[model samples]
Target: MKAGTPDLATLGHRIRHFRGERGLTLDQLGELVGLAGSQLSLIENGKREPKLSTLDALAAALDVQLADLLAREAPSPRAALELELGRAQASPLYQSLGLPPVRPGRGITDETLAAIVGLHRELQRRASEAIATPEEARRANTDLRERMRARDNHLPDIEELAEEQVRASGHRSGALTHREVSVMAERLGFKLIYVDDLPDSTRSITDLANGRIYLPPASIPGGHGLRSMALQAMGHRLLGHQPPASYDEFLWQRLQINYFAAACLMPQEASVAFLSQAKKEKRLAIEDFRDAFGVTHEAAALRFTNLATVHLDMTLHFLRVNGDGALLKGYENDGLPLPTDVTGSIEGQWVCKRWRARRAFEETNRTTENYQYTDTPAGTFWCATQTGRTDATEFSITVGVPFNQAKWFRGRETTVRAESRCPDESCCRRAPDPLAERWAGQAWPSARLHAHVLSPLPSGTFPGVDDAEVYAFLEAHAGK
Candidate 1:
């Protein structure tokens, strides 16, 4: 009997799709097979058949069973996903690669859930080994820099960079309004859900060892900016990184990227300058800036928060836009501890003054009256103060910037006073509730952007805020 006359060429075609779905371009797979891409294409399309040794080599390169490589055709979505993910895992792009796959049954597990946490920890033994060190990162950075140069050479326009940034941040264009963040999540298939919907002290956001992703909602009273932020953050974690085993680290990363995203969207000198002109003339109120600069109020306020830079003295400089809820962005310090009550809504006041007042009082300015915050319906904040007994009483210059960079944080967060602190004790309160004051509105973080949505983990879930347990788990996975 003749050895099965397998359509050896068709078998090669099957392998090609597997590699493609795994996100390997033809060149990459062909290199593995010791042939140029054109040669592989000829084989895959059935013009020729690879030798038995060649086929085996291809299977080894792809990490697939040779028979399966020969047999698979039009693989399932999950299979295709595995290929795409495998590519990401093995790609030289990520600084640190292969975050522990999310476990099944994931929605942020509690630390004390009485667990396989020990096993989970042991699993991390190999994970740290995979951490992308600075040395490994150098190559990726070089590659990125080369790509960036190529981008500049090809496009060379600021707007083009904006579009590219939007794409990489995992969002689409044509709907980049104040609400586009939610739209992006919707596109990704996530839903806007309430924190109450999740168990208390849940992982909140994470990746499971089994490969699912979960994130909190994007809507909250006045949380539009945060919603925008969470859209990218959840999208990113949903993409390359995993939730940090540590909350401080996790939140810090979130804060860093959120700031970076803002910088990307409304990029430097230009972005802040537009904000400055708007604030100086009071033309960019939350509703107003949307139409003017075509950005969200949260973004405007974020610019305002940068005003609290240590570079400036008690002379407070803030770029107050607006936002609300539990996003944890409004507080000048990411290190500030959060309250358990989870106060979810602050009215539409700017976020810079609360911290400015803290700095002002720390700078020897007398705390004044308890004022009902005009920005919100919540408690009072340090609104303003007299520079001296003789300074103009009505206006403490409404917190103006220096004529040049003298008062700016690298020339950012251009802000002006909406109002000075009222001397009436009833109008201004010296003590500001960091959490309550940080809040600017009550909108829920938007539901997950469908485009940003992801499947839940059914395998191992994230450990709760327990440090040691999570550390051990991370250590175990790191070792793995």
Candidate 2:
């Protein structure tokens, strides 16, 4: 055994230890790392070298320093992504990172990123093959784990499944209908609730990453209408099989996943590059972002709020509101009385006023909106701008970016930009199964986790299906 190597045997023990300390099971950890347990187990067994991003995720999920992943004299091949951190180390602050997980998702050349993405594609491809043996899958893993593992765990209990799917949909923003997403979640024991769907004023799964499902006293459709979730909605995520032991541990797990998604979606280099460019441009322009990247305005705008200490910058805030014009999640940087992880509320009168005005307000004075550092999660950020807007629709960006080198003290508010976000809602519909999507031509490494969000390796081809029919839906959607 080598001095610092996080060898397979000990690695598994340590991993299991860390996971237990956090009170997360293999399934929960996989969800945090955006992977399935089998694939993760294979990694634990040292059967495969984690792609750099996956390794970074494991670090975050485990709350270990990136370097602590192993004591190897040299880093894993995935370490290639770490090339720049050495340069980043010029400052004493970022130097002793100890291989802590820093998100390494996007910056690789499209080719390199594509290569890493190919690993996911292969993973997906293989899962598609296994979907055929649905029964065999159930026997291999725990109930909830099996459901997630199968990714095809659709069952007859539609309503129950929808609730579960809604909860999982919270894993991301833009949730779909309860009816639609439920089918997906129930099969897996996911729990989802809605407050009011109308401006979607409620707890957002995208906001919390991993937490309980919040159900409003009144559904969006009203007392007697369809199930609807609304504003100020908040809840804890049901870990399906493995329940967390402590509250802090649960919150920690949630933060880890939130960070993981951010890391995976935006690679380190590209993120900095983007900030620098945004700095040069003064603010990020929304339309340019959407057309350029094929993203919805809400996703783009929300991306702004997701910005945290991963980079340096002045903090910004988003005002989550209720239909009645009351504030649910307050507007504050990572500072002041603002929440460290959850959203706060505004006076109900504010809601009425806003509804009357039919507009949004930028709170500048600390009197109405200012939070202290402790008020936010560790590594809080500030100074970001809006980026999702189009000719008609608009999304509000909430996260902050690192401050500009020439930044100065002044008015706290800026329009920055608006993005015309795409309205495509999140779907765990489980229709045709994710296996179908791979056959239909999904983008590799798309944060969405294609057909094979489960299974183990990228082996086994979906033998019987013809490639042409496999991609029919995608082709049709692409049809002119």
Candidate 3:
């Protein structure tokens, strides 16, 4: 394969290393290879790519194989340090400082290079930590959402891993049982131990040294909560995740673990088979999927996004919105115009009142799913939303698809329809002119600020986790 910019840099470093080992000056090597000293310097500094013939000649002249000259590894420890410094200086983060690049040469000792690289790494760490701010976090989330949309929100590798583990645990059908989950944990060399004093910030903790997974003593209402938490804890080990060094990494790890848990709860092969048959019968519905998998409505809706496009050739979107209209979670590969901030993040933004996600809150029937067809600027979509509640807030989970593909779903015939022109101030953002005129200056409502908006993101190796409490819990249970 052809080398990219970073690979070219590695090749250049290898060539330079070979030349130095042979004690050949640039001019002498250039003379032997029939190239100018300036040309050779350009090749060694990674400023230019050498022709295949030129590489062969240089490799022969330096008494090394072409493969050796093209190797990706740094030729020496000092060369590795030099390469790191070069990359740091070339990065946009370092360039933003408006400082001149420092060239590595005889005058620069390895110790000095090490110090420079260390400082650059520290700068990068601080820069990453700065993203914990709300605006920055939104931008990061926006970027990650775009990545998911591009891939249809499917992770084949994680799916395969979950399938292998699930099959190994002897779970071949509906609703992975609590006993099966414990068996899977045992297969991974872990024992599940429920305790009453888990840190409030954490749902579960894994003591790697002791091969124990500590969870809450009380059973969660649905029973899936504890199962999901246990699988997520094992996900870290199964997925080979390390302590995240930045907010972006922390978010990514959380997403992966959540996906893993869902995949285990609803194994892909089984889910696809079930969904395929449902589609054939024109009865695909989130409620059936949720009941079949024994997961929450939100998990079933989110998992539909994972498989719908890949297996059923149906693009879809999902939304979890609070009763107050704030978007808690969202994903779309179809052209649904979910509300977004300037940063492109949908979370915490308000959903349009005309859309089913928000309108579901106004419905009186809380037991059954609410279905509607929305005509949006992008296209018309049919959605089914189910209202749910927790001790802290009331929310709704919605799964939707394009109008053309709605025929395969169970609620496609619903006559309820509406129009939305979101991102436009007139859609739901602005009140009617008469109402605005009547109430413009008279209203002085107090706004309720969410605690997350004012607080900085949780700080530590694992964000939001209280390390002291976790350590103490582990210490107390070590002898048990």
Candidate 4:
């Protein structure tokens, strides 16, 4: 309800919990508080701000102290203050108002702090903007990662649905053929359309009301990406998930659909059997998985994270990075140390040049997967990376496991090794002292921000556009 206020979402949940505990309905609570049922419902849903008097009345009606509704057990006072400070720093409205960004560990009076937060709320109201920032994105990633870790990053529900989909389509595993995928889409009631000149921002658009899926020839022509996109579109339709209301929810929903798509492309039972056999023979390779499952290396790498972590009892991490070394996507359940500032941002941080993922960019041999063992503060991790070029950028997809688990991978015999102290100074990122001494004043590399690093957060609707615009465009292009 208010910017930088103690989590109102949590407070609202507590309010609902207390109301249910006391066996009170919204109408009953509203009556007791001399408020309307609609107002109470809005307050409970966190859609409306309640006056202090109203909160007091609701507290009285619920027989709980207001503090009980707002208290959070974790996050030390310093940490909580830092989180609030981050929200303020990332606030565009705060920036527009010419207010100084709040820095953690900076002492401020309660009066100053309240004023800053008040201005933040006022700015939000004036701008009518969604507060999606790097800080919020990191928080979202952390929340989703926690949920995935709780379930070992495996979705049994989606897996079951995928298996059922396979059986219904008369395809019992391995790889779903294009004809089978077409039949599956038809059965799901979506007519597929491929347009050679679809917008770059849109990969595939689902006009659910008309039951059509418009795909771009460039983004997904034919192969793993195409099938994955088709199944992903169908996934959104069949899984019954509403469009996301927040950036974090959008990311979570995307992953859910992608998991479903992967499940359909490579059924869990069959994939596991192949992976198990590969492991038994000590011949696990991304290429082998990709060929066997008829998916891209990226898909294979991600699916391996899903299954290997849960089924094979292997701790793993996956990363997709661009040529500029910015992490586009990453996930780890194995406590891998990734680059992050104190604010916990991850996606745009520069991957250490010495890491296998970064080395993939310089790789001339496109067919061979780059492998390396890198020692970190945590320990040595063996990673394999494959490079590929998209129309927009050249990128690499990498998967890594702890050194002990390297024996289970095909590239275990690689002699490449490097020491890394990422997110730390004095690592290989620093130019060698000898070179620096020789050319201290003669040479320098220009520092330029990678465009991806500066790219704005994807809209809550489709990947890069709002839902209304997408719908309107679809309406205009409906018949043509």
Off by over 4 Å in 4: 1-131, 197-200, 217-221, 432-446, 450-463, 466-469
Model 2, 1-480: lDDT tens per residue? 345565554454455556767888778999999999888787654566677688688889889976666653223343422333322433343343354433444455545644644554454444444443323322322233223213221122322333344444443322233444344434334445543321222223222333224344342332211222221122122233123332323333443333232222332334446655765655544334333333344333333444422343544444444433334333334332221211121222232221111133343321222211111223323332232233654323323322342132121244232211111112112335567766666545637543532543221122222334324422442322
Which 10 successive residues of model 2 have the least lDDT summed? Answer: 419-428
> Could you arrange the candidates by TM-score from highest to lowest?
3, 4, 1, 2
lDDT tens string, model 4, 54-151? 88888888898877755553124433444455566666656655766664334776556666666666656433323365566777886786788778
Q: What is the lDDT of residue 108 in candidate 1?
A: 33
lDDT of 1 by residue, 143-243 (tens): 43234323321222333443445555454332244445544444455533333233334444332342322334545444444545545544454335565
In candidate 3, which residue ranges exceed 4 Å CA deviation?
Answer: 1-131
TM-score of candidate 1 on Cα atoms, chains taken together: 0.30
In lDDT terms, how accurate is model 2?
0.38
For candidate 4, report its TM-score. Answer: 0.68
Q: How many residue pairs clash in each candidate at the backbone level?
A: 91, 72, 0, 0
lDDT of 3 by residue, 1-480 (tens): 384323767778888888888999999999999989999899888888888899899889988887777777889999899889889999988997899999888998989889999999998877668448777778778888888888899999999999999999999899999999999999999999999888898899999999999998746578989999999999999999998877777888889999999999999999999999999999999999999999999999999999999999999999999989999999988888888877788999899899998898899988989999999889899999999998899999999999999999998989999999887889889999999999999999999877888777776557778778889888999999
C-alpha local distance difference test of each model: 0.41, 0.38, 0.90, 0.78
TM-scores, in order shown? 0.30, 0.26, 0.75, 0.68
Model 1 Cα displacement at 139 (Å)? 30
TM-score of 3: 0.75
Name the candidate that leads on lDDT: 3
Model 3 has an lDDT value of 0.90
Ranking by lDDT: 3, 4, 1, 2
